[model samples]
Target: MSVSTETRIKWTSADLELLPENGNNYEIIDGELYMTRAPHWKHQTSIARITNALVSWSNQSKLGQTIINPGIIFSDDNNVIPDLIWISNKKLESCVDEAGHFTSAPELVVEILSQKPNDIKRDKETKLKLYSNRGVREYWIVDWQLKQVEIYRRYEGKLTLMITLLDDDSITSELLPNFSCQIRDFFL
Candidate 1:
């Protein structure tokens, strides 16, 4: 009888740079690597709708910037490209590095759920815990198929589910003052 020992490879930000410039999306979470193919048309449309709303609000408020598919590098071992991110000008100045990658958590991170089971898990469970632990003030999980948005706000030092806005309801964030959008807008 023989005993075998196996060591898992821990991925880092540097490893991501070496990948081919294909359309695939790759992320390193807790030193593990995860990949996803290009998003569907519906996903892209939802992102566009959400981005437009956030951009319009931010422009008037002059509070921060709404970025689409920004690379948020929380650590060498935890680099993720969220669907969208909203970072205040104050926090943005400190978190963004010379390379234009966020070195810390943004004020709000938005992720659109895919139909794939693994992708859904990565967004809901893996990324939820990651964002909560890393001090993301707010997180939104947008489900296109279900046409709902799950909002998580930081409470008691952890991201807690505050609400789920249905198509009939409007989505609002405490992090974004005076910002509200009809949930139906996301699908349309």
Candidate 2:
């Protein structure tokens, strides 16, 4: 929502550029400025654990490159940052802009869900719809509190539930063969 002190100013991708690097996350949705609070250490721990495994798989298989917190101008009015994105080398070479934003959607985006209510709702609904419509093929929502990951894949241009991975399950992407890890590691 509109929380910026600069009242009545519409937030845009260009406006996001004007923000100082103040260790805060700013996102815009439908012309509203959403100032996201910094996440807790638990969030960082989960991300680090999962990223380590992803890096290992990517390096071993040469599948692609993984980036953290990629700034993307999804639309003229939506300039949100995703937590982690894995882009196939082919897409990376062709779609990465001079400013480092990916004009083309990444193959996969991983969102580490926070305890905050808005964060949960936005990740499950807002981001799911946004990324899916933007052509992100795979979306993974990681919930440390639940110790699970929900995978949504693009099917016929709509997001469909691909899988719900629990702690005991080995998480694998049907889209990315040979890339997988134990689901519980994400919470550790």
Candidate 3:
């Protein structure tokens, strides 16, 4: 198949109102529209594992809630469907609008990189910069290929590399306070 080189059509959060309910993941980054195909089985499994771990911790602590594929609008031109979003209980109401979408940045955004080269590159570079610039408290990049998870936390006004965990290591969040999971478990 030939790779398309056409520039994407510009879009805003308002444009999402016209879109029908579909399996395709629609997002807008810096005013450009991007449509991602449904995730593969391994990708879905990894997401589920992370969600499972977060759910257990959040439930017991009453710290917050973990949601899958929530529309997070950082700006009119920057709308994204994160793989998993965590909102702390304190700011959940203020962040989420009446439409059940987050109008502001969530505390944490998790992205499980796919096997596709374009997506892999975008998550590591482009999205990392976007989330950091938008003031997301933490960002997690999960790489099944390398069996590792990279956590970035806001520090000194920029997102800084907090920790890089291998499959054998566990992810612990000081913000979450007692929340953790084995990196290997997230892949399984």
Candidate 1: which stretches are off by over 4 Å? none
**Best by the TM-score measure:** 1
Report the C-alpha displacement of residue 139, candidate 3, in angstroms. Answer: 0.6
Measured with C-alpha atoms, the lDDT of residue 178 in candidate 2 is 78
- Candidate 3, residue 115: lDDT: 85
Question: In lDDT terms, which candidate is top?
Answer: 1
Residue-level lDDT of model 2, residues 34-96, one tens digit each, is 777789788878888877888888898897987888887767688778889888888888886
TM-score of each: 0.97, 0.90, 0.90
Candidate 3 residue spans exceeding 4 A from truth? 1-9, 19-21
Structural RMSD, model 1: 0.9
RMSD of each: 0.9, 4.4, 4.5
- Higher-lDDT candidate of 1 and 2: 1
